[model samples]
Structures are given as structure tokens and as C-alpha cells.
Target: MRVYSKTLKEFLDAWPGKKRFGIYRFLPLFFLLGASLEFSMINWHVGEVNFYRTYKRRQARKIAEEILASREST
Candidate 1:
């Protein structure tokens, strides 16, 4: 399906003979590799206290203060 211009639906529509089942090598690479190596490349957690967590918390507190101030003004 990737190599040719024809989509799976189009190819199936042009199938010869009367058969309900058809073979497709849709994700040939994933099938042959037999592993989800793509997902294994990332480190899910970097330390319990990272810059990312600190930045997010700081930003959230700032936004909350802004919201409270706006409500008081209104």
C-alpha cells in the first residue's frame, strides 16, 4: 500500500474472483521487526524534581493569580 498509489480500499475494489478475504502488508516494517522500538527510545521520567516540573508549576501559579486578580477587579 505504501509503495503503490492505490489505497487498500481501492485495491480491494479491484480484486479478481469472488473472495471476501485479502492479504495486505500494511505495516511491513513493524511486522518484520516484531518490536515497538519507536516507543522505547524515550525516557519517561527524568528525576523526581526536574526543571520541567518546576517551570510548569510556576506558570500555573502565575496564571491562577492573574485569574483571581481579574475576578476581584470585575
Candidate 2:
């Protein structure tokens, strides 16, 4: 844990003011950062997860199926 302790010390040293953030503010930011990193890595799934696509391609497929079902009843 030497690396972690050293990094922690560095972070504490870098704070600008004499007043510090309370644990409440600090913990939430830490958890948010961790969760964001988790989702960001999942985005690397690319093709399987469609990471960069604005529109989900599955919407068109579902609409096509519904249209075909309606035509069959005629």
C-alpha cells in the first residue's frame, strides 16, 4: 500500500486552502469517479454494446416485425 499512501499524501498536499472538504463531499466524488470509470471501460465493448451509436439499430428491427405482423392479418 506504499503507492496508495504516497498518492494520498500527494493529494492532501495539493489542496489549495486551509479549509478542507468534509468526508461527505469527498466520498461522493470518489464514488462517482469510480462508477464513471467503470461505465467508460464498458464503452470499449464497441460492436457488442454499440458504444458510439446515437440511435439503437434494434428500434428499426422491432418496427419491421410489427409491420409484418399487421400485413399478415389482411
Candidate 3:
């Protein structure tokens, strides 16, 4: 286990650009990626469909179905 951990650490330390700019440097890149994904999810659509809109409708339908099923069972 110790050997594997040491090997993994070495592999990560050898990642490109890690020497020039520590691991923290990748934080901004990931942040921008997340922001861009959020922006697209909010703004981009296919014809009139949207990611969040579909997700919300599906969740509402699921809850309604659960409620109906429970009532019928009782």
C-alpha cells in the first residue's frame, strides 16, 4: 500500500505544468469550466427545450406519480 501511494504521488507530481505552476493553478481553470457549464445550462436550448426546465418537469412528474401511487395503495 505504501509503495502504491508513493508511485501515485510521483505520477501526480510529474503532471505537465505542475512544476511551473503548483496544483492550485488548476483551480481557476476548473472554476471557469464550471461557470461556463452553468452559463450554457441556463442560456443554451434546443428549439425551446432547456436542461433545467426538463429536469424540473421530470422531477415534478415523479413526485406526482409517487403521490398518486401512495394514495391508490392506501
Question: In terms of TM-score, which candidate is strongest?
Answer: 3
Q: Per-residue lDDT tens digits of candidate 3, residues 1-74?
A: 25468778787667667767887756877999999999999899999989999999999999999999999999
Instruction: Report the CA-based lDDT of candidate 1 relative to the real structure.
Output: 0.61
> lDDT per prediction?
0.61, 0.67, 0.86
Clashing pairs in 1: none
Which ten contiguous residues of candidate 2 have the minimum total lDDT? 16-25
Off by over 4 Å in 1: 1-47
> How high is the lDDT of residue 36 in model 1?
51
- Sequence-dependent TM-score of model 3: 0.69
lDDT string, candidate 2, 1-74, tens digits: 25468778788656554256543446766899999987786576756664434345567778899999999998
Q: In candidate 1, what residue range of length 10 has the lowest lDDT sum?
A: 36-45
How well does model 2 score by local distance difference test?
0.67
Ranking by TM-score: 3, 1, 2
Instruction: Sort all candidates by lDDT, best to worst.
Output: 3, 2, 1
